[model samples]
Each structure stands twice: as structure tokens, then as C-alpha cells.
Target chain A: MPGSFVPAVVSRRRYQILGIIALAALVGAELLGLSASPPDRDMGHLQKIMYVHVPAAWSAFLAFFVVFIGSVLYLWKREERYDLLAAAAAEVALVLTALTLALGSIWGRPTWGVWWTWDPRLTTTAILLVMTVGYLALRSFVDEPDRRARWSAAVGILASLNVLVVYKSVQWWRTLHQVQSSPSTVDPAYALGLRLNALAFLLVLVYFILLRYRAARLERLVEAQAEARELAQGEELHV
Target chain B: MTPGSRRRLVLAGGAIVVLCGFGFLLYGGIGENLVYFLTPSELLARGERAYDTPVRLGGQVLPGSVRWDAEALDLRFRLTDGTQTLVVRSTGAPPQMFREGIGVVVEGRYREGGVFESTNLMVKHSNEYRPPAPGERPQDLYRTLLGEERS
Candidate 1:
């Protein structure tokens, strides 16, 4: 059973604790962000969507940053573990990016009068998502483990570079999208709420990535064990 | 180095060069041509070059200038960047949040008469978000959007 291949980083008790924490954080953050914050003066209740949308976009960027680090380490040290970690991070990044775009589209309808626009900020983000899909596809297609890790690491590193472009696109060009917002940029009333929700989403991102990483490591362990068993049987037969 | 690893290195190098070329095309080539929208001042600065061409004009809706004929589905307003303003005409139901003194981007042609024949009208929302004050209404969101507020 795959149960025997469970990695130390993925102990049952730790997983349960993290799962519970993530759930509580998500619930508490949503409650505070939606209920505590008043309706935005201009956007009215539409601003409440930011509690989920902004945090998801931020978390996706964070996940891509993790991918960048893992890919860099894998290339430098030639480590399979780093490749697996990067792959797991990429999967989570894809999900979060999709959620970010979907949420943005939903918010755009009522506020912007359209579902999408080819503005620099929107275009760059869509490109980032496509690049991530290519990264995952490249990993899956390569047959050799070492070659797969090396090539995927190179792609992962490059793909993550686009995250920076996505962040800066609003400022670099004239677009319909608004510029970046932070505590210093927005009002104090919203700044605090955004920060709390971002932290809560961070917890959720960490839990999902670690869980995916654990599964990846277990699959690799099972593959190695099977290979070792086959080699042992061949040696005994030859003897 | 073994022949295989050397080949791998060469392949990686090639990939790097190709990606760099692509990045150049992205930011250098496409970025220059892909002007998403232009402000009223910037577009008008083009003078004769701005007329007859399809463009997206972005700026705030000048307060007290909005005219909507719901029966005719005709909407018109003066779009301004404080220093420069242009009249915009559209034929559609304005968004639910459409109001005066808020940012908007209208897509269509800039005719010779200085009216923007807009086929598409979109709101260009600011990033700032302030909670509604007690008893404050949505229309009163911007206390002073008369070209003085940075946001």
C-alpha cells in the first residue's frame, strides 16, 4: 500500500492540524472581510469580492515565487526532490491563478461592464496562466527522470519570471485596469481587512502545497521501491 | 564532460536564446504597438492623426455632463482628464454603476467633430476603496473628483 511510503514531512497528525487551521482561517477571514468591512463608497458591496479575489491573485504569485526558488535549486544542485517540490507548487499555482482570473471576471462584470478586456494587466496575467500550463505539460511528457527535472526546471524558472511582468503591467502601460493597491495606497479601513485575509489565504496555500508535495514524494518512493525489487529478482535469477 | 551532458548543455543554451528573443518580442515589439487605451489629453495631442481611427479613450466622466436617453438607448457624456475633455456618444444601457466623475474607457472612433463614437463603454475603476460613511450614498463616493484628487 502507498500508506507505507508516507514521507516524514506528511505525518497524519500534522496534516490534520494544518487542515483544521486552514479551515478556521478561511472561515474567520471571510467572515471578517465580508461582515466587518463596510460597503465601499463607490463599489458598494462589490468591494467585498476583493477579500477573495485579491488574496487569490497574491497567493498565486507567491506559489509561482516558490516555483522559481525550487527550480533554481534543482538546476544548481541537480536534485530530484527540488523538481518534485517545484512541480507540486506549479499545480497549486495553476489552480490559484484560475481562481484569480475567474474572480476578476466576475467582479469586472458589475463594475467594468464587461467580463474581460485586453488591457496590459489582464493580458499579462492570462499569459502567466498559459505559461504554467506549458510547464506542467513539459514535465509530464519527458520520460527520463533526470532530463525531465532539468528541462522542467529551466521552464519553471522562466515561467515564474512572467509573474513579475504581471505585477508591473498596470504601471508600465496605459490600460483600463487600475494600478497596484497596498496598505499605503488604499484607505486604512480596507488596508487592515486585506492584510488579515491575505494571511488567511497564505495559510491555505501552504497547506495545499505541502499536501501535494507529500503525494509527489510518496509516488517517487513507490517507483524506486519497485525498481529495486525488480533488480534484486534479476540478480538472484542470474546467481 | 560526456557527449550527452554536453548536448544537454547546448540544448539548454538554445532554449535560453529562443526565450530571450521571445521576451524581446513581448515587451519590445508588441509592447510598443499595443497601446491599450489613451487619455483624452494624449489622444487629442495626436491632432489630425487621432481622427477617423478606432481608439479607446479613457478618463473620468465630467460631472453634470451625462445625458442618457433610455428610450433611444443613447448615452452621451464629456470625458475629461482635467486639462483636456472630449465628448463621447454611445448606444447601450450604461452599467449599473455608471455615474458622473468616475473613470471610464469608451471604445470606437474619434470623429472630426471631436465626438467619440463609442461602440463599447467600460468603467475604469480606481484602486482606492473606502467604506461607505454612515448614511453616505454611492453617488457621493467621491467628495471631490473635480480634477483635484489624485485617485
Candidate 2:
């Protein structure tokens, strides 16, 4: 609480820098992936969709991991800031996860000839997306801040475990979805583009999480101020 | 640790344990049969049990085994897993990227005859992506690889 206000003031002045950097990185990465990478020998140009979809998945996982960490820390330390941080990451994670699913669906319809499937990898990931929406819904339904934070932290920890299950679904079960693609798995020609886009998406995740966290903190501060003013008025009336 | 933190820790641990148990049951109850699809040999091993009911069969398309009639929408191919092979027949057009040696999962039933009748065909692509060499653009190669010509 002591150092919180100082950083809040500083962040207010400089947060736009993060947004600009994220935008520039994203544009450059898209260009590199779309132009520099060659067409696949098999799927040809359709393979280019991986540049966006894979990175979206990666950023979503990263955001969810942050939510897990924030939840655990909040439960252990009983801090209000950690709960706000987790909620912000959860929101960003939801967006990125939805983006990943949409991109995958668009790519799938062309290649797999279906918009959706009950494959293990796809199903588990869908469950994660649904759980995230439920987690956010749970937060909104609760009124008391401490109770909301406590219960949501508990739920976040539970749902975060699904991330590991979803990541391993392809390997653990024979799925329509392919296994993880990395430098060793993917061709050398396309690896650089994937890495660049992944870096760009990571920046995007950070920007969104920080921006949301700042807004949440400001909202809480205003609410606290209003409550303080009401208490002062009550005391003056009693006097 | 304070009593409150200790209580929180216990609550978190209990929730995790309960969740894991639920996950295990879900996996054991349904995941045992969810291989997505069975290979030629796996389905064959099932013998009479694999008949009538819907089944998903997956394997590599054996080279030179594809037959397609665009007008009739009849497609037939032999799927193999190196150890065994089986015939797959469907009434719909196969996917664009369906080529010899590409992996596919076809869903239907092993009818009275030998063929595995597929109601739905899904392509399972490999993770690798290699660009065609200078002379062989995908557009040039695309026309010949659409399951009509044996490559």
C-alpha cells in the first residue's frame, strides 16, 4: 500500500508507451510471418495461420499462468492487489483464448473440413475457455470484495490446473489436433516467423493485463473514497 | 503462519484433491475409449465388436489406393498403419489436402461387407511445414494431388 500510489502515478504517465510498443511489435510480426515465411509444401499458404493461432494460444497460456500465480499469492498473503491482478489476467486470458479458438476454427474448416470436433485437444481447450468465462461470471455475481476475492482465488487455482491437462491432451490422447510445434518440430524456415509473432503476442498480453489492472485499482480507490466520505458525513450528523 | 492463512491452505489443498479425483473419474470413465480413432489393426483386433456401431478409423492413406468420382461423390481409399491396412469408403468429397500418405480419420461403421463406411472424413495434418522448392509451387502441384490422380 505504501509504494502503490507512487507507481500508480508513474504508470498513469507512461502506460501509453506499452500500448504503442505492443502495436508496433504486432504489426511487424504479422508482416514477417505473412511475407517472409514460405508456403507449406503440403497445405501451402494455409499453414501461415499457425503464426497467429499458435501465438494466441501461447499468450493465453501465459496469462492463465499469471492468474494462477496471482491467485496463490492472494490466498497466501490476503492482499487486495493480487486479486485485482488475477482478475485482469483472467479477462485478457479469455480474450486471447477466444481468439485462438476462432483462428483454429477458421483454419480447421479449410483443412479438416469441419468447423469443430470432439477431439480431446479441442475439447479440453474448450473446457478451459468455458471455465474462464465461469470464473469471471462468479466474480461479477459476488458483492463483497473480500469474499469475492477469496472464492475466486480458490476457483482460479482449480481452473488453472486444466491448462496443463489441455497442453498434454494431444500427447496423452490420439487427437485430430497435432502435437506441439517448436523449433525442433517445425521447419527451420518457419521457426523465425513463429518466434517473432509469439514475442509480439506476449507483449500484447502484458499491455492488456497491466492496463486492466490499473483500471481496476483506480475503481477500487474511488469506491474506498466514497465510503470514507459517507462515514465522515455519518459522524458529522451524529455530532 | 497465521491461523487464517493455515485455514486457507487447507481449503486450497482440499479443493485440489477433490478436483483431481473428479478429473480421474472423468478420464477413466470416458477417456479409455477416446483414442479419437482406431488404426486399421486396432479396429481389426476388435473383430465382431467393431461392427454395426459407429467407429472412427484413422491411418495414412496408402499410395495408389485412392478412387474418386466427382459427379457421384464416391470416394474410396485404403488406410494403413504400416502393420495393417483396411478399405475406407465414403459418399462425400474428401478434403482438399487429402493426399496419399496424409493421415485421416473417417467416421462411420464397418458394415456387412469389408469396407469401413465413412460418414465424415477429417484430415489429420502433421506438424511440419515445408515450403515447396522453386520449380514446384503449391498451385502447380495442387491440381494433381486432389485424390483423383495417384501420386
Candidate 3:
């Protein structure tokens, strides 16, 4: 009775509303990025790519951080919900990371004069992308729920730690990639657009993670129901 | 101690051990693989040890020292770090952004012939947003027919 108190569909509706709001804000952020931000003196219009690139990268980092926390919690508590949450966050993080890399490549062609390079930051980020893909692939291979949860959680934790290396790669080694930009380093005229876009991306990240988590939970629920029905039918045949 | 507390202690101990192992590996990997960008003076400071090993040489392209053979895809330039200079030779067309007095990073091994043999060249832009100074524009290098009419 308590489990049936609140229906799942109601929660999904809330996520839908949030998703709409996020989409609208993202559009607004794009408009601001195009019109409000001043062009870089050297790079000129090519610098506008940063509005999407930096925010997507930041959101990817944030999503992976969530995966790190979820994995740690699942490992400690042995909770299925934490595992589900971790899987959902990992999925979102992978998508955002791929987007970040694509946008980066497009920006690099005009700015760095190369479509891709083996610079330290680029190399480390590429490694991160590969590791995350491996993490998701590993999750799919394990059929047993508990085993999948434990193994994927461990991998997720390890992959999350690699994110730190990616962040510090520019500083630790010689790289063609520019150093991290901050409010102090970035021109104030461009800062407002960047910050606005970053906020819009954060909203989108939260909405996506929430929807993905709910879908994962629904999938597990259906699986459990199917297993219960199979067991009941076997008992009926015996009777 | 209660079994729950004991289990927690074991879990925490395992986590610490795994994290420490990972940290050690990461540290060693970074230490071994970190390629430093050095000026010619810094590279020469290492003496004979710097020869034959790959390095990223970072400095400004010295003015009036660039030679480009577009047909042969040959590029030769002198890179200077204010105090010292090194001659660099490469087998590719220079990047569109490459210009005299601009910063560049050339990646390659130093050969015995006193020339830095570069396999890859990257233009390095400054973090600050500054317009090109007067007479520093690449457009000025061209003898425009439009400019002749004005003259």
C-alpha cells in the first residue's frame, strides 16, 4: 500500500516540465551568447564556440562527479537505487563528454589550426571518453544484477578519478590546448555569456539525469515483475 | 565492536588501499610521460642529454629568419627566447597563424647537426586579447594593386 501511494507517472510529469524549462533557458542562453558576448580580439567570431564547448565540458565533469558519489554510496551501502543512479549519471556524462569533444574539435580547427592534436589535455580527455565507454559496456555484459552493480560501481569510481587528471593535464604537461579559463582570466564582456550558458547547461544536466534515473528504475521494476510472474506461473503448473 | 562497525572498518580500509594504489600509479605515469616545453637555452642547458630525445621547443619566431619553400613543403626558421636562438627545420607548410615575432611550439628531436628537426609545429596564442599592432598585420606583406593606385 505504501509503495503504491504515489504513482510513477506523476514524477515523470515533473521531469517533463523541468525539461521544457531547461530547453527554453538553453535557447535564451544561445541568444545571449550570440548577441551579448564581445568577440575576442585575436580569434574574432571563432571564440563564440566557447559558449557551448565550455558549458558542455563543465556539465560532463559535473555528471561524472555525480557518478563518483553514486558509486561510492552504492559500494558502501549495497543499495540498488544508488547503483541505478550511478548508471544513469554515467550515461548522461558520456553523452555530454562526446558533445564536448565534438564542439572542441570544431573550435580547434579555426583557433588551434588543427582538428585534433595529441596535446596532454586532449589526450587525457580522450582517454576519459574511452574509459567511460568501457564502463558502460562492462555494465551491459554482466547479467546478474548484483554482480553488475558491484563491478560497474568500481569501474565508475576509477573512471571518475581520471577526470581529475584531465582537468590538470594542461598544467602538468606541455599542451596546445589553452589553459583553464576563469573569470579572472576571461574578459568581463564575455564572462556574462559564458556564465549564463553554464547555468543553462547545469539545468539541462539535472533534468536529463533525473529522467534517466527514473527510466532505469522503471526498467528494474518491470524486470522484477516479469520474474515474479514467471515464478508464479511455474508454481501454478506444479499445482 | 559490533559486526556492522567491523564491516564498515574493513570496507574503509579496502577503499584506502585501492585509492593509494591508484594514486601511486597515476603519479608514476604522469612523472614519466609529462613532456615539458622548454626554450632553446633550457634545452641546451641539459647538455648532451637533450640530444635525440623528443621535446617541445617553445619560443618566438625570430623576425627576418623565416624561409618557406611552398613547392617543396619545406619550412626553416630561427626560434628565439630573447636570450638564445635555435634553428628549426620542418617538412610541412607552416600554419596559417604562423608569423614572425609570434610564439610557436615545435615538437621533435634535436639532431647532431645543430638543427631542431620538427615533425609538428603549433602556433601559440597568448591568453590576453590584444589586437595586432600597427605594421604587424600579415596583409601588409602583400604588394596590393589597390595600394599602388593610392600611392
The segments of candidate 2 whose C-alpha lies over 4 angstroms from its true place after superposition are: A1-7, A11-13, B1-30, B133-135, B139-142, B145-151
Off by over 4 Å in 1: A1-6, A233-239, B1-25, B45-49, B133-135, B140-151
lDDT tens per residue, model 2, A172-235: 8889999887677688889989999999999989999998998878878777778889988999
Worst 10 residues of 1 chain A by lDDT: A1-10
lDDT of 2: 0.83
lDDT-wise, the better of 2 and 3 is 2
Every model's DockQ, to 2 decimals? 0.44, 0.39, 0.18
Residue B139 local lDDT, model 3: 28
Q: lDDT per model, in order?
A: 0.83, 0.83, 0.79
lDDT of 1 by residue, A29-143 (tens): 8888777777777787888898899999999999999999999999998877788899999999999999999999999998899999999888888878877877787665554
User: Model 1: which docking level applies?
Assistant: acceptable
Write down the DockQ of candidate 2. Answer: 0.39
What lDDT score is found at residue A165 in candidate 1?
90
Among all windows of ten consecutive residues in candidate 1 chain B, which has the lowest summed lDDT? B141-150
Return the clash pairs for model 3, or none.
none
- iRMSD, per candidate, in listed order: 3.4, 4.5, 6.2
TM-score of chain A of 2: 0.95
